[model samples]
Target: MLDDFMTRATLAGVGTALAAAPLGCFVVWRRMAYFGDATAHAAILGVALSLAFSMPIFVGAMIVALVMAAAVTLLTGRGYAMDTLLGVMAHSALAFGLVAVSFLSGVRIDLMAYLFGDILSVSHVDLAVIWGGALLVVALVAWRWSALLTATLNPDLARAAGIDPRREQLVLTLALAVVVAVAIKVVGVLLITAMLIIPAATARPFARTPEAMAAFAVVLAMVAAWIGLQTSYQFDTPTGPTIVCVVAVMFAVSSIASTLRRAG
Candidate 1:
């Protein structure tokens, strides 16, 4: 039987994988990997706010992430290069969050844990929060899948079809925020975007359809989480980064195999 901590940690990691994988399909399709990083970075600032005000960390992270996503969407679409905007926003949020967390008084914060994740140390309450946020994201994405795919393919087409592309974008944005909030516990701020993007990228070669890519991404992510946990346990490495490293390796292997298949 798994110990309680191991069980909670497993659940936390798996739940995070479940939410991040499918939504990450949209992130990959939209070429919004940097945007995801921006939101995840903003989550660190949310942590500061939550710690300072004694609020729930999940709530704080979600609110700040949503605001950041909205701000980027509003500011970047008018003649600005979104890639540049997202890069600026992502790094700026991380820097500001680190500085702000340093200034918090009274309560001590685990800087490294928030930066690199402390999955093995996750509490039962944190487990509940993680699963809750993950499910909400999954449900939101499932509900809007068709509309989102259409908008992602062509916003003008979506508009002509009477679908408001912006609304679908907002739905994705909301789901992303929730995923970032919950993922902070499993993979921390710096590595959270990798958890979203890598598995999806790895699955891309094997998947003919968006749905297949998403399913494969989820499966790959779950495997990474489990293997990463075991690897970290055996080597006494950092859990979150360990998971990301495993995912990165998988991506490398997939890329190589895909290239060889194409060559043949």
Candidate 2:
């Protein structure tokens, strides 16, 4: 089954969705959408550095993403607006990454692949990385689920219960970096946060509990991945953006249904 490129691509997409949906729940709950973008955008710089240093792209992306996430976490609430901080760092990192990539002489790199993804060309090694990273993220999030929830819902309450909200934030920061590293291959940097945000957002209107929301987001995400791959194959459209488009459509439908249900 993995012999086929399509099979590999589908599995990669599903793996990415698996990891992204649950973490995306935290992202939505914490209103860390911009934070996600910043981490993802910084991944381009990682790609450049990886090519320059001749290391694995995953290692470079992971290292740079961790650094970016840590920087954002550290600088948050240090006398600047969150959006402003993210906007500055996010665009600057992307601009710098593009420039850095341009400076790598004799290397014919496809910026579009890193920016928008090249999922249809995924290989067995890629599958291993995607699923391995996905499972690791799932385990990490599950292990910290209760503590993370407590911190998110009420930091003071979490403190009263002996859970440090800062620690939980670090857990999320680490997880976000991992997701960005793994997903850079699947959806690329530009659209990684979309995969993270859309599934969780689409699942929100129907889920009454955090667990339910995460599960629904996973299902919605996998379905979007499958449908998006199929649609892209059928229409010869871009795979990464197509997957995001499908999820966005799901989000719109879910939102409309939720609105009608509430109205009725």
Candidate 3:
């Protein structure tokens, strides 16, 4: 039974890593770390809503994430600094979510689980949700990969080519919403951004092109997930943070290697 549980956990972790890897590339490319954080932080509000409504936690989280994305897009369209707006929304949503969760009369919510995740507890149903959401996100991204890349690399160029940058931004935001919803269970709100950023950041040093970078990021994320899981098992530590720490270590190593290569 122990082995079975570990196997299941490992599979779930890999699936999450695969899904996060590609989207994470876009997050890094566009410098959307703050946006990712804002979306993930708003997930706490989704958790609160799920508890209150007795809905699936992922559903609540996805809805709130999409709403937050829309709000951010609108705010930015009105000329607000994206980082500043994201920061405000991130902290405000987190605070409101905490307060909202506290108002529940019965059934105490595990704060740690929402913040840092409880990967070992992922059910078969949860796996289905993760994979399904991931497929949709990957499909959407693949279908629009060129346009998205063009918009990210040069919005003016994409616009001149008749690709609406605003529309692509919306698509990216929606993709991010799905990613946050699926990943919340794997890495929780606090570490989800790390999963999205670190792998892509690490891959940057090795990639010769944007496509290679994205693919490398996915591979790194998967490796990190496996190594982190093994380490968690060996050390009897929390899986989500452990995985994030592994990804961080990979980023550090990649940074050093990149610096040395440049120097040499």
Candidate 4:
């Protein structure tokens, strides 16, 4: 029999993987990997705010992540480069969050858990939040799929097709924020972006279509979660980083295979 806690952890891991896969594909498609980093970094600030306010971390992270994303969206193409802007926001938010957490001597929270992860410590309540948030994101993405794809291809083309590209962009931004907030418990702030990128990237070579890529990403992410959990359990390793390591190894293998195939 699976240990009860391990069972919850597995469910949580699989839920997070399902959420990350489709959204990660969009992140890869739109070249918004840096944006994921920035939003996730802002999650640290959310942690500070949640501690200060005595509210749920999910609410705090979601608010701050959305703000960070919106701030970037507004600043984009307005005489500022995306990479520079995201880098500034990402590091600044992280630094500020660290500083803020330090000032909160009145409360006690483990900073390392927020920075790295504490997936093994997840509870039933956390599972509810994780699954709820993940399903919401999946539904929202599915609803906006066509328009989002069109807008991602070309804002002008989307506009010409009577689709508001800005709206679609907002939809994606909102979804990304949700991912940032909910994923904090699973991979924490530092590794969230990796969970968002690596699986989709690993699946890229085997995919012949967009849908196929997403399916492959989901499968690969789930497999990584299972393997990562087992390896971490056996080795007494960090669950979150171990999962990312598994995904990274898969990516390496896929890259090598693709290279050899091309060479042949």
Candidate 5:
């Protein structure tokens, strides 16, 4: 019985790491850390709405994240300072979600669970949802990898090359929304950004190309997931935060190694 549970948990963790890996690469490439934070913050509202409407958490999060992404795109397209607008929207959504959750009287909802995730509690159905969503995201990203990279490297150049930057931005936004929704279940809203950023950052030193960077990022994220899970299980700590901490450690080690290599 214990072995069975461990197997299931490991499977779920692998699914999460796989999904996060590619998305994390894009998040780093485009410097979308704030955008990711915005989407993650909006996830709280999704959770609140899911409880209020008796819907699946994933469905609610995806819907809310897509809406938030669209709103950010539209607002920023109209000349708003990206940072200011994102900050307002992110904090406002989080505040509103807390207020919304407070209105529910009977059920005891631990906000921390949604904020930091409960990965060990993930069910088989959740794994299916994570893997299925991940596959879709991966397919879309793979198909548009070249165009996306072109845009990321030089938006003006991509535009000159007949690629529409706006359209590509929208595509990336949608991808990010899916990533945010799925990642919330793995690492929750507060820590989700760390998972996306840290692993990719750790992989940067070893990458000579965008594709290589992405591949390395995936490997780093998976390693962090495995190490983090083992640490969590052994130390009886929260799984999500432990994963973030592991990723952080990886980042620090990578940075130091890079510096040393440069000196040598």
Candidate 6:
């Protein structure tokens, strides 16, 4: 099964979707979409670091993503606006990463692969990393689901219940970093947040409970992955963007259905 490139690509997409679904719900609930962008954009710097230092891309990306997330979390309560801070950090990190990549002389690199992904080129080792990271994220989120939900719903109420909202935020930060790291090869830096946000958002209108929403998101993400791969393969389009486009279409259809239901 691993001998086939399509099989590997499909599994890679599924693994990334599994990790992103639950975390994406939290992103939507907390209105942290831009935050996801910031962390994902920082992944370019991670790629640069990995190449320069001769380390694994996942380790380098995870470390840089964690730093970016921690920086945002720490600086959020300071003077600068959250949006302003994220914009500056995200763009700056991406620019620096690109410049840094340029500085690596004699080493030919395809920036497109890191920027937009090369999922078809994924190997057996890559599959293992993706699945491992996915399972870890799922377990972490599951372990703290109740506390995380409470914190997301009402930080004050969470505090009243002795669940520290800040701690839950940290868990999310860690999970987001893991997703970005593992998903880099699947969706690349530019589209990681899309994989995270789109499925969850699409599932939103149809779900009555948080758990239901997450389950629907997983299903929708899986569907998008499979369909997107087929579409991209048939048309020879960029796979990562095609996947995102597919999910965006799903979101549009879901929104229309929701609006109609409300009207009816």
User: Model 2 segments beyond 4 Å from truth?
Assistant: none
Where in model 1 is the C-alpha error above 4 Å?
1-3
Residue lDDT tens for model 3, 112-154 = 9889988888888888888888888889989999999999999
What is the C-alpha local distance difference test score of candidate 5?
0.85
Model 2 has an lDDT value of 0.95
Question: For candidate 6, lDDT tens digit of each residue in 1-264?
Answer: 799999999999999999999999999999999999999999999999999998899999999999999999889969999999999999999999999999987777789999999899999999999999999999999999999999999999999999999999999999999999999998899999999999999999999999999999999999999999999999999999999999999999999999999999
Q: Please give, for residues 38-138, the per-residue lDDT of candidate 2 as tens digits.
A: 99999999999999999888889989999998898788899999999999999999999999999999998999999999999888887898899999999
- Native-to-model Cα distance after best TM-score fit, residue 246 in candidate 2, in Å: 0.2
TM-score: model 1 vs. ground truth: 0.97
Clashing pairs in 6: none
Give a tens-digit lDDT track for model 1, residues 1-264: 235888888888899999999998899999989899999999999999889889999989999999999999899878779988888888888888888898988888889999899999989889889888888988888888889999999999999999999899899899999999999988999999999999999999999999999999999999999999989999999999999999999999999999999999
**Cα error, candidate 2, residue 184 (Å):** 0.9
* Two-way lDDT contest, 1 vs 2, winner: 2
Model 2 CA lDDT for position 170: 92
Per-model clash counts, in order, read 0, 0, 0, 0, 0, 0
| Deviating ranges (above 4 Å) for candidate 5 | 1-3, 77-79
Residues 1-264, candidate 5, lDDT per residue (tens digit)?
324666666666677777777878888888889999999899899989998998988889888988999999878857678999999999999999889999987767989889998788777777778788778878888988888888888999999999997888888778777777777777889988898788889999989988888888888888888888899999999999999999999999999999999999
Residue clash pairs of candidate 3:
none
Clashes counted in candidate 6 amount to: 0
**For model 6, where is the 10-residue window of minimal lDDT?**
101-110
The candidate 1 region of ten consecutive residues with least summed lDDT is: 1-10
**RMSD of candidates 1 onward, in order:** 1.3, 0.7, 1.6, 1.3, 1.7, 0.7
